[model samples]
Target chain A: MHMDFSFSYYIGLAGIMVFAISGAIAALEHKEHHHDVFSVFFTGFITAIGGGTLRDITLGNYPVSWVKDENILWAIFLGFLLVIFFPKLLTKLRNELFLFDTLGIGIYTVLGTRIALDHGVNFFASALLGMISAIFGGVIRDTLMNEVPFIFRKEIYATACLAGAILYLILNSFSTNGNMNLVVSASVVVLIRIVAVRYNLGLPKIKIF
Target chain B: MHMDFSFSYYIGLAGIMVFAISGAIAALEHKEHHHDVFSVFFTGFITAIGGGTLRDITLGNYPVSWVKDENILWAIFLGFLLVIFFPKLLTKLRNELFLFDTLGIGIYTVLGTRIALDHGVNFFASALLGMISAIFGGVIRDTLMNEVPFIFRKEIYATACLAGAILYLILNSFSTNGNMNLVVSASVVVLIRIVAVRYNLGLPKIKIF
Candidate 1:
C-alpha cells in the first residue's frame, strides 16, 4: 500500500509528539522515586511508539514503523529533550496536550484499522486492532508506572477508539475517497472522546466478589 | 519449519502451564482489590502467552504460536480451571510452583533463541529475543499486578535466561545434536535460577537521585 504525504500523516506525527509528552509527564508525576534522565527518556519513547509497534508486530508488518521511519525516533527524542529542559512546560500546556492526545487517539485508530484491513484481516478483528493501537501505548506507560490503567477506571477512551474504528469501516465500504473516510472517522473519534471527557461519561465499573 | 512432536515441544507445553499458574497466583496475591474468576483467567492467559506473542510479532512471524496451536490454548485453559477450583492449592504447592516456573524459564529461553536463529537473526539479537521470551510474560503479569517487575528489582531471572541463550548458541555451534544442545542450555538456566533463589543472589539495587 502506498502512503501519500497526506494530512493524516502530519496528524499522526503530532500524535506521536503528544503521546511522548504525556509519557514524560507521567514519569515526572511518579512520586515513588527519582528516575534518572535515561529512564525518563526511555519511558517517553516507549509510550510514544509501543502501541504502533505492537500493531505492526501483530500484523507481521516487516521492519516495524519506527524502524523504517527515523523521523519518528527523532520526534520522540526531541520530546525527551523538551521534557528534560522544560519539565514544567507540560503543566502549562495541559489544554494543548489534551487536544493533541485526543487527536492522536482518532488518527491512530484510523491508521491501525486501515493497516489491518490492508492485511486482509476480518472487520471485527481489524476494529479490535485499531483500538489496541490507539490505547495500548498508554496501557504500557501506566503499567510501567505501576498503576491501574486509567482507561479501565474513569475514562471512555478505548470505547471512543472502537466507535471510530467501526465508523471508519462503515464509511470505507461506501466511499472511494480514502482521505474523506479518514477525516470523518478520525473526527468522530476526537469528538466523542472530547465530549466524553467534558461530560464525565464513562462505562460502568464492574465489581465481582 | 517442520516441528516434530518432540521432547522440546512437550517442554514448551509444560512451560505454558506453569506460567499460567504463576499468573493466577499473582492475581490472588494482589492486595488492592478482589479479582473475579475472569480477571484471574485473563491474567493467566496473558502471562502464559504474552512473551511469545511479542517475540513472534517482533520477528514478523505470522499466525503467532497460540493462534496456530489449539493445544496451547487448552493447556492454559486447564491452568485457569485449576486456579479457579483450587485457589488455596497454590500456597500448598509453592515449592512445585517454583520448580515449574524455573523449568519454564529454561525451556522458553531455548525455544525463543532457536526461533530467532531460524529467522536468521544474528546471535546477539537472538539472545535478546530469547531473554524477552523467557521473562516478558512475568513482566506483563507483574506490571498488571501493579508491582515493579521482579526481574527489574530483586531477581536473577533475566540473567539466567541470557546465560542460557548464550550457552545454547555456543552449544549449537560446536555440536549438531539439537536435543543435546537444548538439554544442556535449559539445564543451565534452571540450575542458575534455582541456585539464585536458594542463596538469595541478585544484582545490586541501583539508586540515582
Candidate 2:
C-alpha cells in the first residue's frame, strides 16, 4: 500500500484545522454550562476527529489517522489555544469561519468517499460514509452541548455532502486522475453548501406527533 | 476461535433486547421534536448496538455481531413496535425497565471486556472498553436526543461498570472458568447500580467556568 504524500493530503490537513476551529467555536455557545478549558479542548479535538475516527474504524483502518499523525493533535491544540485566548476573535471571523467550514466539509466528503472506496465498500455505502464523515463531528459537538444536531434540523448540510459524494463516484468512474476527482467533488460540496445557506434552502422537517 | 453458544450468549441477546427498549423509552421523551417512526426505530437500533459496534470496530472484529446475527435486528424491531403501539407501557413498567437496563449494562460490560482482552489489549484498556461498552449506547442515544449524557451527569452509572470490569479482571486472573467470571462480574455491576440508585449515591458535579 503506497501512501501518497501530496497536495491533497495538505488539503485534508487544512480541513482538519478548520474543523477544529469550528468545533471550538461551537463550544463557545455553551459558555453558561461552565465547561472547563480541558472540556472545551476535548470537545474541539473530538469534533475535529470524531467523523474521521468513525470512518476509519468502520472501514477497518487500524491505527486511525490522528493516532498515526501527531500533526492533527497539534492543530487541535492550536485551535483550543486560539479559542482560549481570543474567544471574541471567533465571533468577529464568523463569515470567514463559515467559508472555511464549508470547505472543510467538501474536503472531508471527498476524502471519506475515496477512503471507503479504497476499502472495497460499494459506492452507496461509500457515499453514506462520506456524508457521515463530513457531518458527524458537528453532530457530536452539538450533542455534547445539549442541542439537536444542526444537520438534523432544517439545514441542507448533509445533503450537500451526499451530493458531493455521488458526484465523486460519478467523476471517479469517468476519470482515472484521482486529483481531478478530489478537486471536482470537493468543489461541488462547497458550492452546494454555499448556495443553500445563501438562499436559505433547506430540507422539509418531518413532524410526527 | 471457539465461540460459546450457551447461557451467556442468551443473556447477551436478552441484554440487547432490553437495551433497545431503554433506547426507545428515551426517544419517547423527544416527542416535542416530532420525530417519525423511522427516527424512533433508528434511535432504538443504534442505542442497542452502537457500543458493541464501536467495540468490535476497535478490536478489528469484522462482521459486527448485530450485522452477522439478524436476531438482534429483529429484537430492535420488536422494541420499535412496542414503543409505537404501547408508549405508556414503558412508563408503567419503569421499575422493570430499570432492572433490565442495569442487567443489560452488566452483561455488555463483561462481554466488551472479554472481547478487548481477546484482542491482546492491556487489562486497563480492556476495562476502559468494558465501561464504554456499557455506557456508550446511552451516550449515543442521549446525544441523538440532544441532551447532556446521563452518565456524565451526577450518576454513579459508569463508575459501577468500571468497578465491575476491574473485579472481572481480578477474578479472571485466579479462575479458569469463564462462566463463573462472567456471572460474578455482571452480578457485581448490577448490584452496585441498584444499590447506588436506591441510596441516591452519585458523583459530585464539577462546575468550571
Report the Cα interface RMSD of each model, rounded to 1 decimal: 5.1, 4.6
Report fnat, model 2: 0.25
- For each candidate, report what fraction of the true interface contacts it reproduces: 0.19, 0.25
DockQ of 2: 0.17
Top-scoring candidate (lDDT): 1
Q: What DockQ does model 1 achieve?
A: 0.15
B13-70 in candidate 2: lDDT tens per residue? Answer: 7778778887766655674443445345556777998888888877778656664556
Tens digits of lDDT, candidate 2, A110-207 = 88998877876776667867887888888788877877766545457778898999999999999999888989999999998899889987654333
- Each candidate's clash count: 0, 0
Compute DockQ for each candidate against the true complex.
0.15, 0.17
Query: Which stretches of model 2 miss by more than 4 angstroms?
Result: A1-50, A57-103, A120-129, A140-149, A152-156, A159-209, B1-50, B53-100, B119-128, B140-148, B152-209
- Poorest lDDT segment (10 consecutive residues) of candidate 1 chain A: A200-209
The deviation in Å at residue B205 for candidate 1 is 12
lDDT digits (tens) for residues B1-209 of candidate 1: 34568888887888899899888767766755235454565578779988998898888777677655667777898887777677567668879878888888899999999999999999999999999998999988887778778887866889999999999999999999988999999999999999998999987767797
Q: Which stretches of candidate 1 lie over 4 Å from their true place?
A: A4-47, A57-103, A120-129, A140-209, B1-7, B10-14, B17-21, B24-28, B31-46, B53-100, B119-129, B140-148, B152-177, B180-209
